[model samples]
Target chain A: MHDGILTIDLDAIVANWRQLAARVAPSVCAAVVKANAYGLGMVPVSQALWRAGCANFFVATTDEGLLLREALPQARIVVLGGVRPGREQGFVEAGLWPSLFSLDAIERWLVATAASGTSAPCVINLNSGMTRLGMSPQELQRFIESADAERLDVKIFMSHLACADEPGHPLNQQQLTQYSQLVPAVKARWPEVVLSFANSSGIFLGQEFHFDLARPGAAMYGVNPTPALPNPMRPVVSLRLPVIQYRTITEPSWVGYSATVQVQAGQRLAVVLGGYADGLLRRLSNRGEGELAGHRVPIIGRVSMDATIFDVSAIPEAQLPPIGEAWVDMLSPVLDVNLVAEHMNTIGYEVLTNLGSRYHRNYVGGAS
Target chain B: MHDGILTIDLDAIVANWRQLAARVAPSVCAAVVKANAYGLGMVPVSQALWRAGCANFFVATTDEGLLLREALPQARIVVLGGVRPGREQGFVEAGLWPSLFSLDAIERWLVATAASGTSAPCVINLNSGMTRLGMSPQELQRFIESADAERLDVKIFMSHLACADEPGHPLNQQQLTQYSQLVPAVKARWPEVVLSFANSSGIFLGQEFHFDLARPGAAMYGVNPTPALPNPMRPVVSLRLPVIQYRTITEPSWVGYSATVQVQAGQRLAVVLGGYADGLLRRLSNRGEGELAGHRVPIIGRVSMDATIFDVSAIPEAQLPPIGEAWVDMLSPVLDVNLVAEHMNTIGYEVLTNLGSRYHRNYVGGAS
Candidate 1:
């Protein structure tokens, strides 16, 4: 607690939301606060977006929805994963809608609702093209006549896009065609329902996938939902750990676990707190670089579980801060989570979400 | 809590420790409990080793040492990162021994001890070949003559190997020669101190690198410290999540965000609770496979923030579990953390340690 720190930028997050919302036309833009808002701390993100006039929210599970419902209180919350068996009571009790994908789920919902005498919103997740979740066109037809849909509690019908991140991928267009065909069928069956699609990436696919409502997840957390865009989203989370010690390593000395690095001559080493356990991927051991005093310091030696050794000697003009100096104070600083993700062969989403809980979290920007 | 789960096998861990310990002879074995025992839950691992007669433990930070000391009470705990500039007093006050790497560190420790009117146990960490930390041959000589060394209580002297994991890397022999030379010098300077050198990889590098103590970290957590071994160590952790929904997709139907995948004709999709936020790297979305009812179900579509889609059509012979049924119950009956690690382009260590706390962690295996 005395050393490790994670500083999150909420203002950047709000700006990202506004930017994403601006990209979609006419359709209502909802923030996907699932996976703890891609691991940037969900409560703060949702509240910030809510103040920014964002209305709807989505989470992965009923549990996730429950948490958001408790926090936002006034926002419309949807559970991306349809309600599970025996979990419908909690969902209805909490007023959280489930993304119903299967006929069995629809039947279970009817039975639960009939038994509990509680009615809640439902979204039919239709399988447009990607073979992961959602109902087929035939299943959707069957679901319309199913006991659950006949009772008429459905509010939204939706499907997911699989390749929106790759703008040129052919699957996107094929999925769009399939999804468009299903829309009319769904509407004919349930004339009073709204349509929802378009995750963070889909929101960038223009207004076609936007439908009545658009749900954007990663974009809210500052991931460039549209990878092909000239300018992607700005980073919202800044990982900052303190420098535990700075030592001068002369030639022929090893650093870290296997002592896997060599200092050619007179070089300085800055040992920083937060290792793989703090979500600093071990893959970054020899391949990673961080900014120290605005200069890039290549990580030297094997990344230990709780600390990493950086070669600060090359940054001649950079001044190494005293021990326990925050990452922001380091002379050569590596503050971007996206770069850390790049070094680890992952996206910024993993870096932000897997961030361990040991760090002292401080949320900045936006309304507190 | 009903869905996300991780089961850790302590017996697998202890068995791994013994296997690695057997590889070394005439040398005392020490466990690296750093980074929460490589993210396998520290207290559980350390206690298992203590019962197995392991007496030495190594950690990276003073705070880690303090925590281990409370559970260990009597084990010889060593701080591997040495002492930070201003925190030596706390280490001494807590009766912790630090591995001293630099002249500045030794001097600082002397000053701190002198100011506190108490002597601290400090181990000298020499830079034999890895140039990340430790003293140069010249600095080592100067420290031997310095009054700081004479005044402070030096516990052990050691160096680290850089390429022990590679087994045949030339740096190992070079480090051996350099460390052999420094050993005599260090002994002459401080005759009554213990010595350490071999790490998890070094312990398998014959008896040359093994000094009085050998520190093993990854091996203690069930990773094959020697990746080339014909018979590797058993893995200790297995990750499982519930199947939130099972949906049918007809031809040309897409699933998941961005529409990255499409169903050909008939496909059964299972939406899982675990996603990137649960440390399931997104890259595994279309490339990875999870076991379901003895069938290998290829993950379809893009990995969502909190859900993933897997094609379960291949296992038509097997009946799918209803929604909310444990994914573990639906699996072909087994899962491997190492396999998931491979899909993530990392070692099992990263996957284990980076496991988010959102999981309901269940520690299995009886106490040794």
Candidate 2:
């Protein structure tokens, strides 16, 4: 193929979900399929998980929820980014739960459901020190007493962990304490509302963090949720880009855009078909390396918009594959996304989310 | 809008192309609409440019070339990334000009055309200075002698400038000299062939750099081709992400994942719906600022996958727009892609290319 192929192991994704589900036994594990399942095709990933007996799926917006609903008719679809006042009917009509982060949101949801003449559920986002998207404790207190609050049915009391990845971060315990305080009062009012406390990292923060339900996203997709420890999940993604052109450095030459690096004579450079535009982040320019013929090859100079160059001088000349037949590994088990994330000066989630759309995506080993 | 709206100005794009076309007067201005027109809709951008007297269009691959072909049938489309051996028929059928960078690629093209029994055109990429792609000076000599080469219709002799953005980078003059030396021989061999040089920045390197045709991509998309001076191109993109939630810090509290930043008492924050997954590069965390109610709101902590929080304390509480009513600017006329590119520690092209797929894409002022 002229373009790069992004091989997504759907069986591994299913296996990862099963492992997480098994870990948080009795506590239902939801699949967070937000950001197009972190840039892996959402429809396929969610379908595979659903086939594996997973029921709950979380998406960031109404559009994502709607798309996932089409793929999985009976699965519980929740829109984490709350549906707007006008947009409430779509969520209600579709039976999709929109997370209500404020009293105003809850009030509107109650009104919308009443007008629709049918009651639907929602996920109430509590501000458990995340300080991001959620209702404050003061607002939660007012919500508890409000007469209109009784009309609303919040199925999930979800509060995202702020520092769940860092097991030792004080905020993890602090957030747990704050969230735990409200759980009793919230449980008393809702009675059967599912308490979802742990995110991907929170599950690894121990059983205390996993309350009634756990939604682990990244780790299920092969990101090391517990970064300090060895990865427990199977590698779920691998990328291979075709080496379009290879040339021998007959003379000392400055390589790629801006003349960033000088390559000496006798060096062999192979230009691959992927670049920063393809989610091979610009920070991976010179610092990144890839697997080739069981040997490591270093990327040289700046990565162009459509291509990245690799120094393949280490490969024996006779062993070098012909121009069109050679394909280089950008992400194998050895050169995983975590290592790429380190070179990118970002996290594993950002790496997964940024994987570009130009690749020929191949989802393997899923139910046909 | 619940999701971030990426407002693309097709009128501005046309205006930018016209301005560049005027700068390199008498030289044909080809539009490089690869990478989905630098993440703006390619079909709309190319159709608009084609209407504005652009006779030539350039794309990165056969797929992009074919997509553009379906949109604009008459316009010349050149695939910069040369077509592979088995993929020649599709390019041939689509009438797409695949750039042949190596002698091997040219040989395959010769065979493919021979098998198909049709004579189509191609662009021959020359290695002038950018050692990333194209053929060396010696390879050109070898190509000239080969009997198979003469059978192929080489319509354009194209070479890229490595340091055209930095007119003073010395490689510009060196490349121009090398390219100039080969042009006469190439013209002698294929007299009807168009001699092309200069990228977006090359047009600014003075008239001499303009040979016969100049394909400028970045400046046409509002990226500052000339970084040393004020941007000559009109702004072509504006992004407004809706504020999903607003919260006040009642105590000294940490923010977002990793607990990267802290806010003191009485400070207000607005969480926008767009995040690193939406092409808001994580590098913008803490360092990036946005416009809200004429006040600069600095982004606090790390940018999450589906949201970014901006410290909105500067905006008086009384003036704060009701939760969903307010929208913050990530890229505007004042906060252009070039500025965002600077904050991302990369070029403007990347900022444009990395713009995510989740946004509600609004193309304004294009032909109906």
TM-score winner: 2
lDDT of 1 by residue, A139-173 (tens): 77866666556685778888887777898888888
Minimal lDDT window, size 10, model 1 chain A: A326-335
TM-score of chain B, per candidate?
Answer: 0.92, 0.98
As a whole number from 0 to 100, the lDDT of residue B176 in candidate 1 is 83
Query: How does each model score on TM-score?
Result: 0.88, 0.99
* Residue pairs in collision within model 2: none
DockQ for every prediction shown: 0.48, 0.77
Off by over 4 Å in 2: none
- Two-chain complex of model 1, DockQ on C-alpha atoms against the true structure: 0.48
lDDT of 2 by residue, A178-262 (tens): 9999988898889989999999999988999899999889998899888998989899999998888999999889998899999
Best by lDDT: 2
Residue B195 of model 2, lDDT score = 86
Candidate 2 has what TM-score?
0.99
lDDT of 1 by residue, B1-368 (tens): 47777777888878877877777756678888887777667787898889988888888777788888889888888888777767777787777888877666777888888888887678888766665456767888877777666786777888877677889877789878877887776787678878888887788788777888888887666665676763267767766778877665444565576555567656667778777787677777788888765567888877766777788887673477655654832111144655566677777667667776667778887388
